[model samples]
Target: MNKKVTILNDKHQRPPEFSAGSCTVTVYSLQPWWRVDLLAQYQISSVVITNRVDCCSQRIDGAEIRIGNSLENDGNNNPRCAVIKYTSDSSSYNFSCNMIGRYVNVIIPQNGTTLTLCEVEVYGVLGAISLQTDVALGKIATQSSSSYPMFLAPFAIDGNRDSNVYAMSCSYTDYYFKPWWRVDLLIEYQISSVVITNRGDCCPTRIDGAEIRIGNSLENNGNNNPRCAVITDIPAGSSSTFSCDMIGRYVNVVIPKNGAILTLCEVEIYGVPAVTKKINLRVKFHTSEDMIDSTTRHNVFQQFQMVSALKLYWTQEPELEHENKGFSDPSPVHYIQR
Candidate 1:
């Protein structure tokens, strides 16, 4: 038997002898392909392929490189980046594939063509960070209605998308009615995006026409909030992400009609919390000697501008407090920070 699986194990050394030791057999089949799982999604920049340095280096020509998140057809049906033409002896070929995916596949469609990959190097950055902010997990979840038993309102925010168990994986609302679900972020945030998971077992079309709304208002059951996006289609047991770069305290998903059912497996929010900054200042004068003359008053005003934290605007002449035996108090100066 030939050890055909040795080519994918990170051993790119030139074969000392051609005996199926570090190379795959050149077989005649339309389904000859090799796949690499990146474990997570990434904004890929390029892919590097190292060809076998020994004999049969020409077999890698015409091979296609594909990248995508789908596992359909072993990822061979994904989008193609480039096709390899030829490589010199003991050399590698580089292909720029600026796409986002978790799987990379190498395929050859012609018969009698063997797909051999000595080594494959992928370079990319974390795609999720750029698309969304920090994860809004462990927040409060509620809904307009529930179906009782196990399909409660809290399942949508529990962070589980598996529809196999039904009750635990998804939350089902009563009948085909105008149902709604919402999450409370406790405080206002600059929302970046929202991800929703659809039921996988059956009736995936129940979530069609659902509208996502975000705002700081709870009037009309949070349905009156600003509309973000409307759901058109989502694959069964899959999640779809939508961008909502707005400021809000609530995220609501509601079906406007009364005949449509609502089933959501999971809901995730990403945003940044809002914060306020407070500043305090105090000024004191000891005696009238502090401002004995007009020159001393000018020096005091100039010193105020030197303080980088304060921005002074010379409006009108200061109102001198002549009644005080201590330093004369000037009219309050109005200023703002830069």
Candidate 2:
């Protein structure tokens, strides 16, 4: 248990203390994490984090908010809401999660840092197809290797950041060549974008040259999926948002088969559920008989009148026959497959 002296030191616990001087102080460790369970799943709209009002308010900087269901790694592997880079005198930070989840974790990653929270307020409602909902909720997260125990593959999606020096704050692959991390959405989606958080404490460059791919192919850990983005460079403890705009069920981040460490604080996938659209067909018939003499035409007109009265028909064109038949009306009416 990373130490939280402030939360323990506070004399009043009825309403959370707003001052860092009066509330909780985390131990100086890598990836100090704090979590709250909503008890039931919800489509979260936003999270409001209150920082210490007194000195060391900056301790809250670079912190991240993760929301999701999986208690794997104690909810540290949930999808991220956002990262805090700066704070004002108000010390109140709001991040739009727009996702569904049962647990919310706030963590600081890397080393030589402490996480202090005066209070954390979560605002959300029952689940719905909310635009703010993170599609990565309860999705399966995996990695190429499990070199470190605490920084295993699950931490990346646990929605927590490893801000302190402890090795437990981030995900790590073996020293093996070509390390990778992948998440299965269970179903296909039109991924609009992906947001990735990198370790801030140290070795931020370890993630450079990582390829983000999206597709259903499991070959090479979905590395063969369409390329979404390649991480050229990203700062420690900060996140980069990439536009994928691709369709797939798996999202992968892999480093080419080169020996390099792959660490991720968090990965967020956002998009709408994939749906199949049916092709609409317009059928027309032709005959040699005159419009008035045609029995089929009379029947069609009657049917159209009834259907149209019920407002089931969308369009009507009496001259459509001429358009299909062409000039002089072809006698041996042929159905044009237009």
Query: Pick by TM-score: which candidate is best?
Result: 1
Summarize candidate 1's per-residue lDDT along 1-338 as a digit string, tens digits. 11112134356553433454654554667758888887888766567777775667787766777888899998987765556656464457666544568888888767766777666677777652454343546777788777575877667777554543355857777765678988888888878778777776677677889999999789987889999999997645546667888788888999999776788887777778754343443344444445646787787778777876655654544444655454445555667532
lDDT of 1 at 186: 87
On the 0 to 100 scale, the lDDT of residue 298 in model 1 is 83
Residue 221 in candidate 2, Cα distance off native in Å: 2.0
User: TM-score for model 1?
Assistant: 0.49
| Candidate 2 lDDT, 1-338, residue by residue in tens | 11111223334332334433455667898789888777777766566666775567777777778888899988988866667765464666655555678888988866778888776767777654456335775788888888557877666766554443265656778776888889999988888888777777778788889999999889877888889999997656666768788888999999985788788887778898776443333545554445544575556556645644222222332333446444222133212111
Candidate 2 residue runs with Cα over 4 Å from true position? 1-129, 162-169, 278-338
Give the residue spans of candidate 1 off by over 4 A. 1-124, 127-135, 165-167, 275-338
Instruction: State the weakest 10-residue window (summed lDDT) of model 2.
Output: 329-338
